[model samples]
Target: MNSTAVSVDRNRTLKMIAREFYHGLTSLLFPAICIVCDQRIDEPNTVVCHNCWSDLKVLSTDIVKMKQIPEQLDTILPVFEFNDTIQKIIHGLKYSGYKSSGVHLGRLMAAQLPQDFLLKDTVLMPVPLHPLKKRERGYNQSMYIARGIAEISGNIIRDNVLNRVKNTVTQTHLDAHERHANMQNAFAVNRSCDLSGIYSIVLIDDVFTTGATMNAAATVLKSRGVASIRGLTVAAPI
Candidate 1:
């Protein structure tokens, strides 16, 4: 073999060894535990253990017809019902810097999607976080979730298609009507983004409470001449 090829193989082996060593050290310092049950996680690359994962109560097959969402969105797909287990997982993803939890949850959500849900030219757009908030958090949780979905569904994620123009207040304490008022004109399409070839858009978020954020994003896309918009969340209150 050529010297260059041998060098590349050696570098690859060193990287693999370094990655394994890091994971091993991290595990020794901080054991992987299930967010919901606080049990030790023996598996690699998993946030929640197998037992807790299996115990999660998923949404019924008729979830679309069961919940009443906003009028602006075409449809909303929720993978699991809002409960203690889901709440802890989402909290870890959003507040505790546990991004791997978001990816795991995103994979679960992707599995719940219909077999042919992603069309040939569909785009996955995550709900945008304001510049200030994003800087504070160091990462956009929704973007991580979108990445996981894209990884599983083989779809494309266009993170720059939309921008959060308004830094709205948190909607946790707000009622449905208040949430609607808070998200008004919060999003705008990027001027440089060309939507000519994009056939559809799927708005992704971590949790759905009032559906205001997703609806507002969809409205912006519609004004930009996008025909179809769907919503996907990891969990929602029934």
Candidate 2:
């Protein structure tokens, strides 16, 4: 066989061996039921069973568009809902140890953005978290989601432009008016930095409930001469 064929064969062989090893390990570690559903996973890697996988209602853009993005905020897109499955997944990522859930949801969110939207000039910016929250959580979930979106979208992620001045309350429980009040004066563009000419931006976050947070961020970016600032999130509580 040629060198390329040999390499392919080697990779296939390694994959088979790895699969067997993974199964063996999981057999010992998770010889019980899946967490997502009552069905037996029989493997540590299988947190969700086939039945639960089917139960996971990945919201359609049509539903997301109708429900989440209000008529006022016209430049946003959401890929899921803050319903049962998404709530669980988001909770796991934000509160629990399942960091991978953020990346997974981020990739899914990025995929929903139009291909033309992710050109070479586009920049991805995640809403900033306060220093206190960052220290407490050890990682910013929005940053992780932005990183994942950047990986697939090939857009440059601007991680430093925006800074959070205060540790605000959870926006989940707030109404539209309360959300606006809560997020007002919360974010500020770094005055020391300059992106004088840069325009197109893809703002990323985990959820879009009232859109006050996104509107606040967009206002800051627009003031700095950003031509277009569009928001993309994993879920929207409509």
Candidate 3:
């Protein structure tokens, strides 16, 4: 073996050892715990333990298709059922400052999609959050989800093109009709964005309730000549 190649191998091994040592030290000082169960998490890069992750109900493709997809969207893909487990995880992500949960769920969501679901020319677009609400939250949760999906799907995210024009109230207690009304005219596309070359878009969000939010965002993109559009969410109500 050449001396140069041997030296490169030694450097790579040294770097890997350094990383492992750092992770071990960090884990010892600050133990990771599951978001849902509050149990210690031994996994290197996850907040939820394997058992809690297994408890999440996976949605069948047929069931997802049966759900109410907004007319503006061609279809919607949801990963998990919106049961008690999901509610807790989402609550943490939205209210408890656990933004990493979004990314964790997003990767799982994207991994289940068909290979062609996200094309080379397609981009990920997060449902826009109002500037005021975004300031309060300190970050947009959907952006993290999109980032995670992009990591798995190899697609670019186009969050800059969509803006939430309305500071709509929370849809938590609202009926389906009320949600629809609240999201009307809630989104507007930026006129300066060059979307002509974009072939498709997949909207990412944390949850799917009545499809009201996704529909409102899609309406604006459709007006701008975006022909192919769909929605992806971590979970949806049964």
Best by TM-score: 1
lDDT of candidate 3 over 168-215, digit per residue (tens): 998989998999999999998898998898769999998887889999
In order, the Cα lDDT scores of the candidates are 0.87, 0.74, 0.88
TM-score of each: 0.86, 0.77, 0.85
Tens-digit lDDT string for candidate 2 (79-146): 66667767766776777656765775677667766767677997888888898988888888888787
For residue 205, what is the lDDT in candidate 1? 94
Index of the highest-lDDT prediction:
3
The TM-score, computed over Cα atoms with residue i paired to residue i, of candidate 2 is 0.77
Q: What is the Cα-based lDDT of residue 159 in candidate 2? A: 81
lDDT of 3 at 92: 84
lDDT of 1 by residue, 148-224 (tens): 88889988999988999999998999999999999999999999988987769999998887799999999989988
Candidate 3 versus truth, CA RMSD in Å, comes to 4.9
> The CA-based lDDT of model 3 is what?
0.88
Q: What is the lDDT of residue 150 in candidate 1?
A: 87
